[model samples]
Target: MHHRGFDDSCGLECVENGHDSNKFSLLCSGSAVTYASFSSQNESKAKLASSAAPDSGATKGGSATKIAWEDTFEVAMQRARTEKKPIMIDFYTDWCGVCKQMDADVFPKKDVITESDKWVSIKINAEKRPDVAGAYGVTGYPTIVFAEGTGKPLSVIPGYSPSTEFVGLMREARAKWKPEAAA
Candidate 1:
């Protein structure tokens, strides 16, 4: 889903007191909107979202090649530090239908995958890693933060973009990157 706006406070007001709680809101801008609650008859989106990371087993346009997302946030940072590359952090939730759509349509696009190589890509499950999401001030699902290797955000894609648009977005992030900015 596209984000109306990000909260200055990092937009994490909806995080539940407990990790296991199924109920939580996705606060965006000034509006507090909740994701649809899963009912008994419906297949549980919460279960799917909570099951695994989005990048796991993901391939590029049904090809054998895989998009290289670092296994963990710590690892991605380490790679970025060494590689002197920026970071592309995809902040998403399991129950978010739009997030899944991007995973299927956008991320796997040849251009997106190719463009992604220039950055250290990481996928952080917002529900699973609320701390990280809060730190980034993410107010919506599929908030893609483009940051310096040192983890300073320079730009953000707050919602879904198609393959063509996403590729350009990636380039824009790379262009905005300053190697010495973090120094």
Candidate 2:
């Protein structure tokens, strides 16, 4: 007979040799085992930790704002055109689990936010902006669209991605659609 032991916090099992009829035994297991670890307020926390104090002269909510964008499509379009930056439109719904996960896991990462600053980022509520979502054919939550120039679609990324992959996606978009000088 063979025996195995593990600490209280660890998750491990003991198994007899292949010759034995019974395959294995779970000797010890962890109290909590989650596939994903993140929270909705993660973005706000990350921005607060990474961004500096807002300057008195700073316009609008300043750099510390999470999901930095305006609700108005016209304003977003104007910013994209005048800033000569690529537009990144995020299609999301408040009730979506995956969308919340994206906000918690992906958007909070320093690299994702930093790289996103180069583009004219916008967030469109799938429910409130159903026309925009329909126009872009966004059939899923957390759909990300990289638009080149004014109102020109370049690429669409659908679904929730981890921080590293999300950063890579943004980098790829930047490479494919270089930003023009700000007006």
Best-fitting candidate, scored by TM-score: 1
**Model 1 per-residue lDDT tens digits across residues 1-183:** 232323344333343324325434455554543342223212333433444336575432224255687768998887888878899999888766657767766777777877887888889898888998899998787789999989999897776566787888889889999976543
lDDT of 2 by residue, 145-177 (tens): 988656677788876567887888888877777
lDDT of each: 0.69, 0.61
- Per-candidate TM-scores read 0.68, 0.63
Q: Which ten residues in a row have the lowest lDDT in candidate 1?
A: 36-45
- lDDT of model 2 at residue 25? 29
Cα error, residue 180 of model 2, in Å, equals 5.8
RMSD of 1: 9.9
The residue ranges of model 2 lying beyond 4 angstroms of the native Cα positions read 1-65, 178-183
Q: What pairs collide in candidate 2? A: none
